[model samples]
Target: MKRKSWMLGVLFVLVILVSYMAKPEKTQNDLLLMNIEALAAGEDYVPIQCIGTGTVDCPLGGKTKFVMIGYSLE
Candidate 1:
């Protein structure tokens, strides 16, 4: 019974770890919204890649690692 309980506890921990690891990171749209908010607040915003063009080589590509900014605006 003690061994079974220990195994169950280990399994529970593994399940939790896997679920946490599989969670998706913040998306490009989320970053863009934050950037827009910053812009509205008159603060400098980090540039993001243009998602509309489906390319990371957009002008603002040099600013951030994610593609949150628009192509034309860059």
Candidate 2:
């Protein structure tokens, strides 16, 4: 029983390490769901400081590692 518990603990640790150490997933293909209009408001230029990809859903699909900087009129 103790050995089995130890094995399970080790398995859990390995899974966690694999996930954390793995590189961030990406979408090489252009996601049609993403567009300028969806990102911006109007003629205003949105200051996007940083952005990252996610699960690739739609309409801001998936998770976004994004940060806003400032705004302006485009």
Candidate 3:
């Protein structure tokens, strides 16, 4: 009886671990939606945009243009 119970406990733990591992990862679109939600909730700052294509007028004067690496817009 004790051996059966130990086996059941191990099985339960294995099931839980398998479910966690099978969970889906968030896509970039999901992240973008989350960011939009946060911005709508006033939890995030507005992203700065460039004024022009040229370096002289780009970055909107005093605004900082951030280049995020390892991030995809897709």
Choose the strongest candidate by TM-score.
1
Candidate 1 per-residue lDDT over residues 1-74, each given as its tens digit: 99999999999999999999999996678889888988888635555445454434556443333355534432
Task: Report lDDT (CA) for all predictions.
Answer: 0.68, 0.64, 0.64
TM-score of 3: 0.41
lDDT of 3 by residue, 1-74 (tens): 99999999999999999999999996679889888987888523345455423324333354334422243343
Higher-TM-score candidate of 1 and 3: 1
Model 2 bad stretches (over 4 Å): 25-74
Candidate order (lDDT): 1, 2, 3
Taking the tens digit of each residue's C-alpha lDDT, what string does model 2 give over 1-74? 99999999999999999998896877555555456546665444454454676443333344556654676745
Residue 39, candidate 2: C-alpha displacement in angstroms = 21
- Model 2 quality (TM-score): 0.32
lDDT, model 3: 0.64
